[model samples]
Target: MSSTAEEKTVMKVAEEEVINESRRNFLKSMAFLSAVFAFSGILGIVRALGPIQMKIPEWPRIKVANIKDLKEKEPIIFNYPLENTPNILVKLGKRVTNGVGPDEDIVAYSQICQHLGCMVRFMPAGSSSEFPDRNLFYCPCHAGFYDADDGAKILAGPPLYPLPPVKLEYDSSTGDIYAVGMGPPVIFGKGPPGSTEVWRDLVGGKLVGGG
Candidate 1:
């Protein structure tokens, strides 16, 4: 073969290799750019959909009544912490030594049902012929019944759980009955401490007449 032909052949092979290297570098660069853009888009989406923190304030305490207001075998409805939250305060007649009463104690419970978030009402023992002849917390929505002494139990209606109990304290000096805290707020029915605008409205007294 001629040296000129040999050189031309070598030059042609070297040119083809350079072109292939350029194509490979172009493809790699495009791939790197695409990956970077995709990663940035993912981060943006995550930032947009991040979990929101609820800012519930500490539970407030409110005076409901004086010790003299509650009577034996009677239940009174009142709002605690906030007026939107309903509560039931009961005064059990004198405590019974065995089964009779003469020195009973006072108790209070949140009226929100645990099963499906229904309001509970106090049903008098003899007022309703359909119900048993004992005082009980009754849920009219689903016929859920709870013991008056405690809250609702697992034995009633669609509500397989008991009602939430509020912490009640009586002021010795003033004889003022106050609710200090709540057991747990209803999840779906009521908004958490500071999660939504609804809570702010409640705090500002736009919904319940006054905050």
Candidate 2:
């Protein structure tokens, strides 16, 4: 082959290689930009969602009842850290779960059912032959119930956790009953059912009337 023809052939190959290299570089640049944009899009979505605003409350100890004032099997409705969040305080005439005072029969629990936020009412022993036991916290909404004598354990129906019991403080000196804190599995609608974040119970509502 002629030397000139040979040089031309070499130049043509070099040009083709240069074009291939440029193509590869262009594809790499495009891929990098796509990844960067995808990550930015995810960040934008997170920003759009915003942060969850929670009200971290100072758990209050509010005096709710006087032992002498309580009547057996009667319920006194009151609010604790949050207004509108009703709790039932009762004296079952016998010792019970978290019961306070001399008889150990005084107890308190959230009125909200763990199943669906239905208010629970105290059903006295023998009040309903249909119920397996007395000293019951019953939810009429779905027929679900709790055993008041036993930490308000869910006895039947669809409740996921025990009725959230109110932590009680008995003043032997004053015969006063105070609601000190809420138990595990925070109240329904505040957080998720079975959530142990009791503080969430204090988040949504106004503090009990005077507290």
Q: State in Å the error of residue 123, model 2.
A: 0.3
Q: After superposition, how far is residue 200 of candidate 1 from its true place, in Å?
A: 12
Which residue pairs show collisions in model 1?
Answer: 56-193, 56-194, 94-102, 94-103, 94-104, 95-102, 95-103, 95-104, 96-100
What stretches of model 1 exceed 4 Å from their correct place?
Answer: 1-54, 94-104, 124-134, 185-211
Q: Report the C-alpha lDDT of model 2 over 1-211, residue by residue, as the tens digit.
A: 9999999999999999999999999999999999999999999998999987766777788889888889888899997668778889999988877888998889889998888788989999888767756679999999987999889998888998898888999999999999888888877566775678888766556777555
Candidate 2 wrong stretches, greater than 4 Å: 1-55, 209-211
- Find the candidate with the highest lDDT and give its number: 2
- For each candidate, the alpha-carbon lDDT, in order, equals 0.65, 0.85
Instruction: Itemize residue pairs with steric clashes in candidate 2.
Output: 83-206
TM-scores for every predicted model: 0.58, 0.75
**How far in Å is the alpha carbon of 196 misplaced in model 2?**
0.7
State which candidate has the highest TM-score: 2
lDDT (C-alpha) at residue 139 in model 1: 84
